[model samples]
Target: MKKHQPAYLKSHSDGTLAKKLAAANARLQHCDLCPRRCLVNRQAGEKGFCGAGADLKISSYNAHFGEEPPISGTHGSGTIFFTGCNLRCVFCQNYPISQLGHGQPFTVRELADIMLELKKRKCHNLNLVTGAIYLPQILSALELAIKEGFDLPLVYNCSGYESLDALELLDGIVDIYLPDAKYNDPRMSKKYSQSADYPEINKLALKEMYRQVGDLILDEEGLAVRGLIIRHLVLPENIAGSEQVLEFIAKEISAQTFLSLMAQYHPAHLASNFPELSRRLTKPEYERVVDKLHELELDNGWCQEL
Candidate 1:
């Protein structure tokens, strides 16, 4: 079998990675990396809706085995949890890290070292969680890590809300896209995530991601090399509109698209304030989504045990 060479390695060797790094950094001057498009001068330490400034803030980094099988592999996916989030999901499990900014800052070179360290640990991939807020810095660190011979697959794990231009910058850089499809209804998205345009934005972003890397491809050892993995967390009272999301994925996107239908939803952060979201997902609600997945004949990826 041919050894799996990460996509970014070729981009780095051909000098496109440097060009991409420079372009990503340039956006910081008038940042519009995410869908928020705050246009704040992030390069000058001005804060936006995401609360990130010039420096990169990260909560933690380690090889995490809790991810899907392809990501975790025999060892684990190298997970870096970044601080602050562009999307303000009221029920976010990692609210402290994403909303409260519970982390220390790091220089670009230090961030590069973290990636190299994960590579040395024999991780399957570099899983960047909640990193849409710090794309420019990520590109810089990736450039540095490439120089240090860190050539693991890059996982662009994120909330579904993303800017097409920003994703274009990552065309040849990111190998795996692990994104969420939180809600199919605009009203539900507005109530939960404060973004009514989430469904449209998420669909476009997913299309772009699918274009970059097709369906999930696993190595002989069942590890993800390159692909699109969509996650849908079932919410209470069918607020997430799981059936519609599954319908869209089956029709609009490929029926062969890999999906991770999650059943872990509990009251956290501001979710307790909302009556509909103030409880865990019921068994019936979760099973309904599961039924839709089977009904749609979408037979790829994993599902959590209810």
Candidate 2:
């Protein structure tokens, strides 16, 4: 069987990657990278809602084995956890990294070196976690990494609140999109994540991701190469609106779409402040969402046991 060549290699070869880098870099001056549309000029050291500046800030980078099977595989996914986030999720597990920004800054060249190092470590894919704010920097680093013969499949792991413009720049570059369909109810989204438009934006982002990658395609080794994987974490007391999220995926996106129905919703960060979100997901709550998944015939995914 022929080896799977990543989409970015072709994009790099055709010079489109350079164009994308240029386009993405231009947005840093008036930053509209995510749905927040915080027009702060990151180039001038202005911080926006995400709290990211000009430099690329990363909390850590390592071969992570905790992702979905295809993503982690036997070798593990090379995960780069970027600092800061557009959405301020009250129950964020990594609030110290995302909200408080506990990370070191790196230039584009250094970031490129990290990507090469991950490739050298024999990672299955380069998993970029919550890097929507650093789109330009990522593109710049990817361009450099490609020059150094880095060719691992790029996994864009992100919250589903994305901008079409930013996603368009990554059209032929990102091989796999791992985005979360966090909430289906605007009120729930607003109260929990501080993003009232999360549901509307998340739906559009999922459609765009599906349009780009179609469905998950695995190799002979059962490892994902190019695809869209939607993760829906079942929040306490149906706060995540899991049923409606499944319905949207089944009806709007293909029923064959790959999903990661997560059940590990433990209260963290500011979750204690909200009574509804102050506890771990009950088994009944999780099973109800699982029932909905089965009823919708969305069988091409993984479900966690509560």
Best by TM-score: 2
Model 2, CA-based lDDT: 0.94
Could you give candidate 1's per-residue lDDT for residues 70-95 as a string of tens digits?
A: 99998999999999998889999898
lDDT of 2 at 248: 99
Report RMSD (Å) for each prediction in the order shown. Answer: 0.9, 0.7
Model 1: pairs clashing at backbone N, Cα or C within 3 Å: none
Runs in model 2 with CA error above 4 Å? none
Model 1: weakest 10-residue lDDT segment is 280-289
Alpha-carbon TM-score of each model against the true structure: 0.98, 0.99
User: In model 2, how large is the Cα lDDT of residue 203?
Assistant: 94
Q: 132 in model 1: Cα distance from truth in Å?
A: 1.7
lDDT to native, each model: 0.92, 0.94
Best-performing candidate as measured by lDDT: 2
